[model samples]
Target chain A: MTNRHDHRLIDGRAVQARILTELRAELERERAIRPVGRLLSVSIGPSPEIEVYVRNQARGAERVGLPFERQLWPADITQEECKRRIAALNDDAEVLGIILQRPVPAHIHVRSLQSAIHPLKDVEGMNPASIGNIVYNDVALAPCTAAAAVELVRETGLNLRGLEVVMIGHSEIVGKPAAFLLMAEGATFTVCHHMTRSVAMHSRRADVVVVAVGKPHLIGPDMIKPGAAVIDIGINQVSAPDGTLRILGDVDTDRVREVAGWITPVPGGVGPVTVAMLMRNALTAHKRQVASGWLPPATLRGP
Target chain B: MTNRHDHRLIDGRAVQARILTELRAELERERAIRPVGRLLSVSIGPSPEIEVYVRNQARGAERVGLPFERQLWPADITQEECKRRIAALNDDAEVLGIILQRPVPAHIHVRSLQSAIHPLKDVEGMNPASIGNIVYNDVALAPCTAAAAVELVRETGLNLRGLEVVMIGHSEIVGKPAAFLLMAEGATFTVCHHMTRSVAMHSRRADVVVVAVGKPHLIGPDMIKPGAAVIDIGINQVSAPDGTLRILGDVDTDRVREVAGWITPVPGGVGPVTVAMLMRNALTAHKRQVASGWLPPATLRGP
Candidate 1:
């Protein structure tokens, strides 16, 4: 049971489930018109962390009625091989939505595969065309995690317009795109990272906080706004003194809940929401392809 | 005489002259390979202010031995008409580079024209494709003002790695892109606008300060690093008590020069550097078009 000290925990499991349910209906609507919705993920290694992340994302896709393929290559795969796979996905008509999961083998720089992905099927928004579309207000997709964070905050019925929101971290996947996302929603924001003078100083004055630095409990109650909303985006499992593994948020969830009016827990918060968003993007991507008369000949259902 | 305080001003005037000289040599080089580069500017309205900026930029173009044409439309011109003229220039074989002067009638939106311009001729980096190219780190041009300000700072011989930078604006045209530009160079930065907190605190700690908020004298001597370099990117002219117009920067120049080791005066600092950068972009645009082998017969050039 959740207590007052924990405030109201954001049920990411339920949120993601409900969002995927909505997506399933959209997928049916899309399929009725054209049955060519397929999703692809480009993976480089077999690390436990990367595997679990992609595994759950696949589950979410299945629930939302999209076929997912995990193209696993060796850890030491050459950059050329990775690019070849991406180009193949671009050429493959069956694959509508593509996500090249991050922490991509350090050798495989993200920028190399951007041009390889078809801009319409770029669900992960790692490509510049997708990001530019978001920034320029064109009809285009956004990076899943950043877009999910923004939509989740909005789902909480939080009014972002003209709100003093402070975002900590600036990875292309989260921070930079999220700033532009909220800016589009009329919430002026400040982005602080390792290079910033004081992260807490900016966080304390904000009405809403989105912390995605991925460090365990990096943000504590002392750094939060009184009665503010906290969304913890870190999925870190740190070993305790007793040799036990404990999942933690970028925020000290225990202390922050007492001060925050609304809070999203670590494991159940942004993590699940990201998968749901990806599934939604897949449906949208397939719909565009079908409408443009470019889908593969996989008509599973009738209109 | 320019004193030691102004010793290494990077003298925008001198830099502009040198760039034009190089542009002329490049013209000869280009003519030897292909055809001469030509420039065209589409300025809306006869606002003397817009006219002055356009004229100065053109003068910089001429100083480099490149010829140019100017098309001035009425201030009441519709967005459709402006775009039509811009499209004509874009399709014109003689026009290798197109400069669309800003402050477009206060009611017309320029975004409509952003996607239509050839990425090669987008000297301002205002086009969506150019912005996308920057985000992806592809081979593309940057906004002239941001590129110039960065060059002027590096021209002073400072290594930007891990350096503290305070940018006092958030416009895509100047401050925001400048932050990304500096960050790409490994400099840590903080972007501030009307909404930032304790801006003075951030500014004083910067090893380098770039103020582009367009407010006259927003920064004072106290808001500067001792012996720090200042590049004023503002172009504001305010009337004094005696009814005379005076140009000032976001920084208080008179007192800041005492504490600041180097400074670029408001009028001559970033302004001339921007024009020089534009010429450089124009030449580069011409080269790309020539190399692409798609130049129309009338405007065709070869590499």
Candidate 2:
């Protein structure tokens, strides 16, 4: 493939690969001593929307040499039953972490199920406890997509301490968590949402701008500073003029890259790194479990 | 006492009084049907600093007709024992909520004890679960001081929707939680901590500025925009020229008040409202418990 994009384009796949390589080596050292656990993906119904995520996560896990399993419950499963199954996974010694697929049955209370996953094994970081820990600057285990956004921002080599960051969303999953993560990095951040009167005003003054508002091309070149880094976490699909489907990010990447010091492109930006973050979180969960004595110490096997 | 301050001074006592009065009436109605539970304050060691807080909380509980209990555990109590006692309180029907006092013994893990308190009985909202819930826009149960700061901002009659809010400080207890509360109220907030390069730059542009950093007189008149609302959550004790003790807030209130449309005074500002917020949270906890079937419905009593 011919390389046409400029150097300002943040290659998320390259970042994701670097993380997986490090994680793979770490897991190899861990596996030499004891057995590693599998990452269990629980889908409490038919969730076609999350199938892509499942495949990406499985691929990432495989690259890190971690076992991956997928479970599909009946679409009509009761919320109580769903929680009961999650509790079982939480207690399972063979399970390293749990990933609860979204778009669960309408009857199932997703938050309740998320809460059921033990924090030590909450690789997806969807649990309220995991989210809450971020407030205390405990960002080791955080939501994957949010962590991924922060990771990409770090990749830009911007000095996080005292950096001006503007997060263009306040969602529970991405924007809010990302704000706390930035805070943990000692960056001063402003959160803007639909309620914000002027997003550009904040973005233009920021050293870095992260958008997760699920709006395509919402940020233009004029909205960014000349040397500011822009992280686009939005994944929106729209039909092009040729009657073909296309994925677009919140930032107008074509024009933004011309002005932005660095920018993350759609499809190849936050998405791949998000899967990589899941892998990193799984390793962190495993290491924490061992440190906390929640899991048995590794028994030396045959050399 | 003669009132010397101008109308710009926000009387937290007044706001607190109004809240307590309404709670008193509501508790009276509940009392006619059934008994309200007591708020148990657990102190691990002898720390005289929180004594005033204990008294204020007791008084607030009394005003609302809720029973209050102050339990002083041994200074050498183990962390496990503290959690055990908290678990018992969580199970007790008479205990409407638990308040784990701060400055716990060095041997004790305070965060662990806070987590031990059941969410339904965490009237102080110090539990991770309660704090995490605020991220999801669930603000009914939040940290008292943070909620008090937000409450006073609301008292200013500023439209929170699209309000330009700048929160100085990022402590987990106050600044961080206050940021989440402001978000829940539809306000655009920026959080500045010790790492922020220019606190005045953000504050000068804010419609409302809330300061929780402990430094006395950290915010000056020049940092604030004219006619803006300033909420001072800092409580610092400093010596006056005569060597007498005087309480000071983060903002230089004397001069800031001239520019600030509304400003809260230290010693009488967030302090009283925090106690009032605790009482309100107690009632909220009780109602949620009842709705969750954790407590029995009140039976009507004969006149």
Candidate 3:
């Protein structure tokens, strides 16, 4: 598949459209009983950057006919405010899946705010319970990025078991949980973080290397196994000749593609799948809460 | 320092004594305010094989003044009966730790029995809650064997971080949890189970090798790196010329000793430390229960 596999590329827009089509019917069935199937994403501040990202997801949810909205707050929002809003969204039965946008203002206590999200509404799996479930290999809602990581490889019809997979980062969102998920699948994995002394050496040995470190083009051709599969989860911004910036992946695309058998370009690869996962999360949340009262509230649907 | 360090000849007895001493004191204090702390181990039938093993552990707990007792059922104890007794123990608070002696016929519901143990009293850390905590890298209790493995290696005061440690076998009691613990401490770990293709290649590459497969002298001098640390946690029986049985570790200590810089002798090494760890688990259980106020009913309390 050419790297031109734009938005619908890896799991491209078409596959996503097909997925959304399924979710829409279930969502309408959900809204038939309840007023609406709700999905509230917590976006701190109206920075055009984060707002655009949130809007893209909102648009994706809308396209699926699943009603969704972004609860935007100031960038310098207080921990109390962030948590209160998340709790409010959680309490609202209409709000099924809760998404807390990343880079949630470094100083605003995102870690503490994460708990404010009820486990049921916690579609992103940021809460400790969700994280524990991941470690225990329990079938609960997993973190979105981790979900995306799994989808990226699995969507390609690859079996991960017994693969020497290397995850390059330890951030709870993308790296750590992904490693645990991979481990639970019986894949041999190693987690290399900032303190990892020989990350390149380690990466070079992997049959599949999944990089999530938000560093622009940190990995090159020499750091990969020949014909290895690479998924660049990181999107770093850099300036162009016109002084305008563009998003670049952690892997040096041109150089890595030579050695990598299968590579996901930054723009067209993991991005579309992640949005699909969100819509799926919302659909699942709606099914559990409004559709099937048999599904317990202590899981799945959460902020 | 000697390869002949004995399980009967080590500080395990001393540690067990200290635990009893402390438990006795605690018991007295509890007596002053509604007393009882006893432990009952249900033994299936009179299999001398299982007897000897459970007896050693029972002796350790007895030496510690745990008010230890054993209830024996026939060797052909039915699954229903075993399940009934285990459920009874879970309801009986006086029984602090329930060790359904191993070698219980394989057809029995082992997972069911394990799940029956109350989380607070699961000193062995086999309870799902404790296992969940361990997976989360939480400061909760850990399985005795795994804890002993860590304590045995950490006793050397060696920095485990950055060490290439290889663990053989994947029992929940020993290998799996030990690997997770070591990984959390930043040790690079590789696991070889029954299905592992090349044990020698993995073992030879290990800087610190933990073998607990219970195959007599399976790991030899040739399977180790020069000056590497060898921790032999396995205990297997071999026949003597007199037609007597002798317990031996998986590592060929006589020869491996010369090559290994540090090693844990079969009898003296992990076994006694395992008992000590069990005692620690009991104390840990009490502390967590008392601190959290999440203790179960009186039926689950100690005598």
Candidate 4:
């Protein structure tokens, strides 16, 4: 039904499904040996948008046969109280992973809460230690969205070694972590941020361009090299000319797709893969916990 | 006596002297209120080369009025024993900072030992948490060599914001951390490594180029843009044409300097500044320890 030579719209849903399928089998096999623990989602304050994320994560856990829980704390909780509760969660054997929902109360320091979560149980990969591990090339656990972007790039079947990648954002979570992940894969990348004089000048010369700057349609066809891969990680809400609200990515997907050899359509691209990555990280946390003796290891095989 | 327009050889000794002077004054003021602690250098084995480093660090500490001690463990010391000793040192009130010398024994897991050192006492900034802190723009404590490269660039009085820079090599301690440090200063940088297709192509377009790969004379005049600043962090020992051994930097300094507006000579460049950074980190560690209540706070002066 589609031209084979035409730009391949990288189906993120397909990639997510594939990864979830593999994880489901692995989780099923591991469940027989040990009792897996539940993931606790800690929401400091009320934010309607975060609920969407929590629901998606809950669904991903369900699909993968992992237990998940939602804990909503009062909006006015003090930073000390938040950290105290997280410390309790860290010591709980049944709590294999802790997810701290973002946009906490004005007074609470988010980084402090993240630091409180034990590194082994940092399923979201937000802890400073988790991020620092990427520098040493220990990236088995990394931020979900950043890991997802790399996963999608891998799905394109492009060799990462020596790949010239232009990462157009420098955010701590996504852009920066993604750059380190690419570096681990031996890709040479240039990180461009707001201060970058000409973002297009760098992007046009890359074999791959990853944009996470949160600007709708910031990248267009003219900025991409023909046959290059484009991974759009930005999710911005914009209003249509006819007064309708819609979600858009940093790239002008429609036009850029014509030039890109492979392109990720944002809503269906990085988002689904991100949720999948969270589920994967949760499993990794379980394995690490068992290995660390915090949780019981698998029983010896039958003689 | 010298041409005003000629390439200025950035003096690392001058920078080191300036930093040490400022630190001496600050240390004198702090010492009047509270007693300072000593730095402990942990050498895993008997490396003749490591003694040189230890001696330099001790001299730097003496100049700044901080106590310094060297603790060399047996070459065959178990990894567990090494960590146990480090843990003990971490708890010692008199021990302000810990430095883990490199080229550790083949049997010892160096990173595990480094991890054993408490973050506050990690004056060398080799801890994962310290390195990770750079991503969040908290760079007060970072790897000494990486920080020195940045300090040298600052010495040139160049505006870091939007500065086009190229970093050659991607070592964990030097090039990688330096890139993050540059990112914190709002510079857009490209990291080139062994896999880079054309290192010169990236270097020739930058306002600044920092090279840390240990291959002597790896960078030459053709790789640099005129009037650019070059910070060479490599320290390599090579046999000269006369069969004499000498230390050389990654850049062909003599030829490259003609094109570079500013350059750091091999032995007098990153090495001196690196030792100064260690002393500075020791001071930072002492302050942090005081703030955390691990040590007594400074007494208030008369109103």
Candidate 5:
């Protein structure tokens, strides 16, 4: 007799407050014509989980009106002075987006300061040329937890083409960029890592599973398939049994929400839609640096 | 009664003559200590199938000693003059490796002259930073038909960690870099494509399938699984009902080599180990441009 609150939990802070209210109405119509881009965020040493994820990304970049900053440095900086301050925020010009942050300092190589951040100001897409331009689907700044786990598997409306999904962590920042953004949405995925000999024989024939393997629960309820659409993107912490320390994910959400039909519930799922996909990848890296002329486009100033 | 040529076919010219005799003894010990790299091969027009693939990559770069030039051009060039002659053979410090050659001329932007070559002389890895450095396993130079279909699935010696695989075709040059080099050798892959709803329900539960969908037979022998390890990576051409023209792959291989225990055939499999993996990606792009000091390291001059 299943029914553990009959599944469907995926609210991710109401899908990160409806993508920060459509990125605050497209940054108030591109900041009423001009001067908008800022992101930055660096942080070299300090962790209380990187200052609670840089104060929840400066309160989701001031509730999506964008502009965030932060910087910091000295925890014995050198990694060539933190890649010369991330190559001066990749030659600033009002830095559209950057993001370094992580428990840095063990001789910081962090993928060479995430390959010295400029895949158009890598907005937390953590550049390897923005994860190899998601194999030429030409993904614009992906990886905010693999674009919030492919936006919670497109909020379960399903039909990501021939969707079979299954992912379960292969990481290079969230299971191979969430299986290259679910193979650019023609999903027929299945990555399963830690050399998956049988992650429940590919998550019980997935229709969508996701997981992101940090492992606390390591998916259960016979690795769900009943009404699939799982998504987890784990954030483990564990320790309970009265020693308290909670926060767990990689499924088993009350027995996979009593046999899944849409799950995602670790501290309200995919962590507030991965901080609203890092403020929609800082307005998609400021509309690809204003469509590659590298910024300077939104003009029309004060009427 | 399955004997349609029992199985174990994977020869690919005996793994391209054991990887061109260990890249001709590491290019005769780095060309008996000196002058060793040159691969260019550009091409723009005159295509009798790109002059039979630049005469099989200048006869596999002169039977592996290296130097293979070609360059061509005028089939109505101009994609900014083929990205200014591939950025002048990417600043030719003796061109180490380039290879643009395809059916160019449809207003040229062949991935913008393959991003103007030079992901350290690309060596046909078709750079998006060498396919996003295969998500930081930092694949020296991949995509020679996805590294000859993961070296014919490691010559089916299995044990790519948890080996399940499947792949079929997502193609960023051979199914998403052979599912990111079989998820960096810890397999359990599964890409499938053409909106895979049921590529025989994930190739009858793979143990290793691979196909690379250029779709000829599209994998058969009841979608292999009996003894798996298939690897096809399609070549396709077909016409022969005595109307000549043959070559065919995407697996049917005389009925999936009677339920594949290891298959790989269709013109001596993965087409001559994808030209000996483009001469082992031109000696792995001249040992990554001599380990990124950008050449000048192999010196040992005259005995």
Candidate 6:
């Protein structure tokens, strides 16, 4: 019998490291000329989960020599106020990118606020316009999680063109955008979601399978095609027997790795890469702003 | 052998008539109070094909009691001139909706001109912003062809939620938007395009299949599941043995109808419904503009 651990485990940390290294060098080059812009993160109220993620992002930005700022608004802030604040940020020249943290106040219309972010500074790529542009194959700025999944597949040295990818999840932020990005790359793909009758039927036939349904271990070994690359985008919290919370992904990593030629692990897989992609997007947003004459090109002049 | 002609063919003309009847009644009600708005269509240069379609649209508009106007532009017009004209239409209070005919002069960036049309007046729903709004399930003014396909599926009276649907082709105007609309309806769907390997594999498993690849007879009887609902969105021109031209759809309708319980015919299937959908969208666009306070509420007053 073959051991599941013997299969290749996609190294998300390595990919993240490579991205940060490149970003660090780029930051150094830009800093030598003019002041680099800061990433603005807006959070309504506080949640321990969001704090941990925000801290991780701050660390990642620091390592890459990128400036980061966190803005905490009162929990009672009205939706209008949020949109107004986001619009102000859109106009701020110093704010290169804006990220409205998830799990915002229940009263907040998250999609409305997301749309208020200027597409140029929408570093998180949560804006509908950015996702829509994917239809036209204009992917300068795409959703981070979706882009990360595509990157992991590309890391396997696979040619995206004509590749068969089955994506299980159709959320606007993840599944749909990822499918669109893959389509743009010339890969024929399928999108499945909660309404899907048989997820395995599609997964078993794909060269690449991306599961982002937020259901722990929803995809098993039987669902994966042998030699296929599996990207697990789900990050679910499960209570262990010891009453400790554990992070889990959509795929049964251990069992799937036995069948899949390559697979991404739960904690170390798409999560780290998503953060790295966020930083990359910020840099991209800045460059685009410069190219579009939104910012002064002279700002890059060396002292 | 079972007769394929026995299966219930989704009648596009019937559905179109149903929609027009409803629109006519509503238009009469609105007209009793104030002058309703007109749908403006801008066509660059002359094409007999486009004229035929535009004439069909005029008839549909007349049937619905809505005002219609067509603006013809010189073929040698610059892109700037095109955008300038579209912007003027955007500012026109009397124009409820705008349609930019296809096959514009070769030099014009068609997409650029589409983007200039105000989203409210974008009756065709070809603008990126309108397409992007589908991400949030805002179908107020979705693309007519895509929406028409969805309407055909709804006409089958099959609950879309949890239905297995296979969509062939991924063109921005048809496949992608249709997929998005189905996703919004809670349907499990797969999108297959030219890069897809073995399109039959996905088609055979679908409870509902929609083909919009513009290839005649791309899907045959062998590809369909028994008792499934088939919606054909393709409009292809083929040459007959006698060198006569004929219209065709993506599916081999006759053979597939033997296996499929519900199917739409080629010329009479999605085509007429699409024209009706255009008129429906025009009315929807007008309503949305009024609701958003962009237009006078008095226009919707009753007798």
DockQ of each: 0.24, 0.81, 0.17, 0.81, 0.30, 0.63
* Cα TM-score of candidate 2: 0.97
C-alpha RMSD of each candidate structure in angstroms: 6.0, 1.7, 7.1, 2.3, 20.0, 2.8
Docking class of 2: high
By TM-score, highest first, what's the ranking? 2, 4, 6, 1, 3, 5
Candidates 2 and 5 compared: the better one by lDDT is 2
Q: Which is superior by DockQ, 2 or 4?
A: 2
**TM-score, per-candidate, Cα-based:** 0.74, 0.97, 0.73, 0.97, 0.39, 0.94
Q: Comparing 2 and 5 by DockQ, which wins?
A: 2
Considering only chain B, what TM-score does candidate 3 achieve? Answer: 0.83
Hey, what RMSD does candidate 4 come out at? 2.3
The DockQ-based CAPRI class assigned to model 4 is high
What is model 4's DockQ versus the real complex? Answer: 0.81
State the lDDT at A46 in candidate 1.
70
Model 5 chain A: worst 10 consecutive residues (lDDT sum): A1-10
Off by over 4 Å in 4: A1-7, A241-243, A299-303, B1-7, B241-243, B299-303
Q: What is the per-residue lDDT of model 4 for residues B80-193, given as tens digits with 9 covering 90 to 100?
A: 888789888999999999999998988988887877889999999999888888887888789999999999999999999999989999998999999999999999999999
i-RMS of candidate 6: 1.4
User: Candidate 2 lDDT, tens digit per residue, A154-247?
Assistant: 9998889999999998999999999999899999999998999998889999999999988899999999999999999999989988999888
For residue A67, model 5's alpha carbon misses the true position, in angstroms, by 1.9
Interface RMSD of each: 3.6, 0.6, 3.6, 0.6, 6.8, 1.4
Model 5 clashing residue pairs (backbone): B171-B175
**Model 6 lDDT per residue over B118-221, tens place:** 88899999888788888668888889999999999999999999898889988898999999999899898878888777788888988899998878988899
Worst 10 residues of 2 chain A by lDDT: A1-10
Give stretches of model 2 more than 4 Å off.
A1-5, A300-303, B1-5, B300-303
